[model samples]
Target: MLMAMRYHIWTEGCQMNEADSAKLAAGLARLGYQEASRPEEADLAVVNTCVVRQKAEDRAISYLGYLRHLKEKRNPGMRIAVMGCLVGPRVDDLKARLPFVDIWARPQDFDAILRELVPENDLGGEFWPETFPEPRGPTAYVPVVHGCNKFCTYCIVPYRRGRERSRTIEDVRREVAYLCGRGVREVTLLGQTVEAYGKDLPDRPDLGDLMAAIHDTPGLLRIRFLTSYPKDMTEHIVRSVAELPKVCEYFNIPVQAGDNEVLARMRRGYTVEEYLEWVDRIRELVPGCAITTDVIVGFCGETEKQFQHTLDLLERVRFDKVHVAAYSPRPGTIAWRQMEDDVPHHEKMRRLHAVEAVQERIASEINAALVGTVQEVLVEGERGGKPFGRTRSNKLVHFPGEARPGELVQVRVTRASAWSLQGELVAAAAPAGS
Candidate 1:
């Protein structure tokens, strides 16, 4: 018997990238390649890179340099591949810079890489199969839409990932059904701007239509979609969340900045008042919805009053979670090409920490209010010797229980903190979608 060829993939960035890695891993498996524990042990090593921020790009470049050294010194026969945003649409410059790379693949383009590995075997059109060989976990991410059309000045996603493209409703439905059959209880539909799903499709179906199609999958207990654009989050989608029992009441809408001037500078396409109206509608339709947002501090030419406006918005919204980042100008973005990155690094960090401090206090207070309330938690797995999971509202809860993974349990909130909740097991609920 011959030993199987081993491969390793190192992934970075968002959930969409994670899904892409899973697809690549499955493709490698189909080609008779076994997974290696580390890059050093593999005959093929792939770095699925992210270049959204300057730091991420630098880290990826440094890792590639390490791999080059490893191939030269230890594993002379090892084949190297670089995929994702780092490679982008054109790789001539990258090819000249990183000559050691055997394959360079664009984001979500798995067929190109797989074909390069095994030239003779045709992958029969689509590289992503309807079902994977094994269940990944209790949770899975499925990309319903790819790329972005919105070119927010500070974002490189549009340039790297390209224009918006949505998978058909039936196609997405099939994937979700297959995942549920293999024991995935929770699915998060993904996109660069998730709310823009189905706009490009022939039937012109929206995300609400997509969610409605997938809501009744046999084993699926919860459905979620994320990184929504405020301008694209239609009333239909909000109503869908209110109507669908399986759909979790959670929204991850990124309000990049709070001030109108900063938002316009970023080309976000919506005003603070407009964003607030959308939030109000969501709250009115779906009470107790866990609203989370992303914020970037110290954009091009942001002043103290502008920064204070963001703080005011944070206080006003009191989001369940706030993802804060200091702006790092990426080359090829509009901000990099046209605007001066006038904010000093120290000032950026200061604003970032300030936003964090405000959010931390708000979150602590909001979670504290959940004490004594019963939350339905789908036990993901054991953490710190206790069963841990998230509520339908996406709040993390750790509780002492005999509940196993994939089992939904009713938990009584005992204590709450800024990040998570402490709970006591109340009862074991029936199987999800029962």
Candidate 2:
């Protein structure tokens, strides 16, 4: 028998963390646990941490400090468990810095954390039956694989989450079908290196085959995937997205640096020229596809010439959007061990702004072209007398409409900004309400 317990989960980091939290919530629910409306009233609290960057770790620690205060003053008996990228054996700071944490579960300690924190008689080996959180909305993240095989010099994911391991194509199809059956219209296949999905599995079905399996899932209106590696992005995968009816025309392929020298230093196999060729191919294959990327400025010893190359790439590529970050050090990454953190803080900021400025200009120009066109948007929510959603291309569109989250509506793009589109509903659609 399970005791009456309520848990509050504090999630941090990427979509992988969010999916893990959803799975954790589902397990807790199966163990007869309810969610606490407030952290102070919870019997158990889980801090899902992220150590991708120094700032993420600091943010988690800050929240844990406050949670510790809550536990000491109002809920001393409450069980506190910390899990995710920041709690693994490699990390050495949690014990001294935040001693109030009752249990520390490493990145792979999913069942152990739940069993100890939930106080159950037996959690039997089978944890996959009621394996997910209830699908409450239109969009859900289904992680196709866990961890990264690529140990990019500045990256901490491989160190934190371990090597690449993929869910079988059958398992992935089952989960996607489950989500769609419960009113989830859109599913983004998640992974640290999602492009590397299905490599470890015995049958060796690639991402295209996995998508083909899920493309016909009933009630599924749209599908997407993220964080693709440039080198592994095959012509077949691009063809799959282009030809598949349900797949959205959005590709989030990251090219960390534009200079070949910098890319080589970072251990990214593909050169800048090769990356540009891939971009050209995606655009040629999937016209009007929303191609987005990530850029890290001032990595270790990157020079002014390399930074200019990045700007030139931005000008040449003109991506739909760019996720820009200034370089930051981590404890065990190759950059930390082998290279100098030679880029000064202020210089890093300057390079970051320069990169952003280039992308912002490119995005604004690209978005500006969307004016006077009709876009099919998935209504996500409303604010200020307008509903907001994303186009199949993943551009955020804010429009005047009566539709709520989950409905697909047509909107005429009346205005455009660098980051979002402003429009008015052109067709009425029934909302897929909660």
Question: TM-scores, in order shown?
Answer: 0.96, 0.95
lDDT of each: 0.90, 0.86
How does model 2 fare in lDDT? 0.86
Q: Candidate 2's residue-wise lDDT over 284-321, tens digit each?
A: 99998988999999997799999999999988898899
Q: Which portions of model 2 miss their true places by more than 4 Å?
A: 1-3, 91-93, 118-129, 429-434
Candidate 1 global lDDT:
0.90
**lDDT of candidate 1 over 162-211, digit per residue (tens):** 89999989888888888888889999999989999989988899999999
Error of 2 at 7 (Å): 1.4
- After superposition, the stretches of candidate 1 with alpha carbons farther than 4 Å from their true spots are 122-134, 432-434
- True-vs-predicted CA distance for residue 333, candidate 2, Å: 0.9
